[model samples]
Target: MKSRFLIALALSALSFSAFAHVGEAHDHGGFLTGFVHPITGLDHLAAMLAVGVWSAMTTRRLWIAPLSFAALLLGGALLAQSGIAFPAIEPMIAASMLVVGLLLAAQVKLPEAAGAVLVGAFALFHGAAHGQELADGSALAGMVAGTALLHTAGIAIGLGFRRANQWLPRLAGAAVALMGLNMGWSLIAG
Candidate 1:
């Protein structure tokens, strides 16, 4: 079962090339594009998954962080759609990856509410960034659905890792953190 799960996870992770980019003109619109955006963007993907993994490892109530993240993500997107500008969006998104990744790696357990607030704050930025690019209401729904699906996947991965080996999740978290660091550096240096 573990091997099968690992294979599936590996395949899913490698199935798509990164396709989303900030400031690029998207000719496509609607649900499909919105759904694929989070999966295709490395920053979004990493952070979303890390949220799930961290949540699973730390909290007895597994749903809180992911729920908070999804809710705030939608809110952020709506705010962006309404033409409200959020400052430091890209930087903050990058920071989400770093922060979440570190939290997972360190296995830090905060109160569920605190964790929810932390993840939700980051979700707002992520939602705003993606929301500005989408064209319709359906797309927003798709994005949120897709994000929730990814969170599910992350939770599964976290659980599998926890059962298989204690260090596995931490290693995954460290990898996520490294990715975040690289992403942040690219944003800064680019």
Candidate 2:
């Protein structure tokens, strides 16, 4: 238990450090840039993986939540490209990460549609961020594919964690939740 907690703490610190330096949000373009974008932001990584973790923890339809997230994420990207601004996107995205962490920690259960809606909403903010990067054509394709890969990774982690001892999952969830809180606070404080 002590070792697990220490590992979680180290991971949380690493995640926080990863997001501390942001040169520009629009620095990503092309296939490689788009592919790497999701991992670049700590909040985004947490949110995406949390969705997978939540879905795995639940007994509902797993694929629906992720698919809905992807489709609506595309819509959000298009909306952003159309010159529409969702002013609270940054904070909201941060909030999504925070909420995802909370849900994971709590192991909350909901019906399929509700879960879909939850993840779908978060996906919009994520997609909007991608759109802000102005990625097009191959770049957009790469991002979508990359996102799917991230979701896959999340699912794998969720499954693997479930198979592990109980405390590890909770520890990981708590770590993610704390990171989300820190991320939100830093953004709001700044």
Candidate 3:
């Protein structure tokens, strides 16, 4: 069972490479091109998935938290484009993954509003990262939309696993937190 879960995760991670750079130098204009950016990158993927898993474990209102995250992510991207700098944005994003992962692993339950706010804060950083990658042109909207779709997909997967086995959520959470810690260490090392 564990191996099967790992295989699923590996497959999901592999899927990311296909959509990693939605609007890079190459201009492949299509829905799939617009939708693969978020899941492609490890940092974005982990952070987004953590939000979903944590929200699922902590809140009764499941959809609300993820939706709030999507909305705030868009807002953050706009802020990034406007040169609104956030201190420790990358570090914070990594921390978010770690915190959310820990919460899920421990099965800690917080109020719905608190969970939303927490995830929203992280979403801003994630969005800003995506915004930075986007070119300043018509592709921006599509890129942003694509990122949101990827994020939503990650959340959905997390929620689905959470429903199947109670332990699965915690295991997913631990994986996310470990990934975050790796990111944090990389940032510090560099």
Candidate 4:
């Protein structure tokens, strides 16, 4: 079972290459383009889900977790759009995945405020990446909605499998952390 899960996570991480970039071929400002950006990136998707899962596992205030992530994610996106430079944005993004995954796996239960701040910080990286792709307000809106939906999915997964088997989330978190190491290595190696 563990082997199978690892295989699946590997396969999913392989899709990171398809992540949308600024000035890509289809780089038009629109809803669908922005909507697909978050989901397309394995790092982003995993981190988002991990945050949601961690929130659900640790707190009954499930809604608060996603809300905090999305709000701050939007803020980061806006900051990115303003042509502001955030050094090591890429590394931060990958690290967010690793940390969030670890948190989920560890099942650490932080205070709600601390949890919000944690996710908010992670969101900045993700939002910056998002800003690069979305050049228009509509696109930004779509991306925000899409991110919310992803959070919902993560929350569902976290809540869904939590009671069935606590190990499931931990396993998923470990896989995400491995993916983060891979991403970080690629950044350094490249």
Which one is best on lDDT?
Answer: 1
Which scores higher on TM-score, 2 or 3? 2
List TM-scores for all candidates, in order.
Answer: 0.87, 0.86, 0.77, 0.88
Question: Candidate 3: misplaced stretches above 4 Å?
Answer: 1-34, 136-140, 151-155
Per residue, candidate 1 scores C-alpha lDDT tens digits across 1-190 of 9756754564454333232354553534788878987887877998899999899999999889999999999999889878888888887887888799899989999999999999999999999888778878888888998999999998888777678776778767776776666667767877
lDDT of 4 by residue, 99-128 (tens): 887888899888888888888987887887
Q: What is the lDDT of residue 16 in candidate 3?
A: 30
Off by more than 4 A, model 2: 1-11, 14-27
> What lDDT score goes with residue 36 in model 1?
87
Error of 3 at 181 (Å): 0.7
Q: What digit string (tens of lDDT, one per residue) describes model 3 on residues 32-147?
A: 44456665667776667667666665667776777777888878867877878767777877787788778878888878888788888888877776666664544456655655
State which candidate, 1 or 4, has the greater lDDT.
1
Lowest-lDDT window of 10 residues in candidate 3?
Answer: 14-23
In angstroms, the error of model 2 at 130 is 1.6
Which ranges in model 1 have alpha carbons more than 4 Å from their true place? Answer: 1-20, 25-28
True lDDT of residue 167, candidate 3: 71
lDDT to native, each model: 0.82, 0.72, 0.68, 0.78
TM-score winner between 1 and 4, please give it: 4
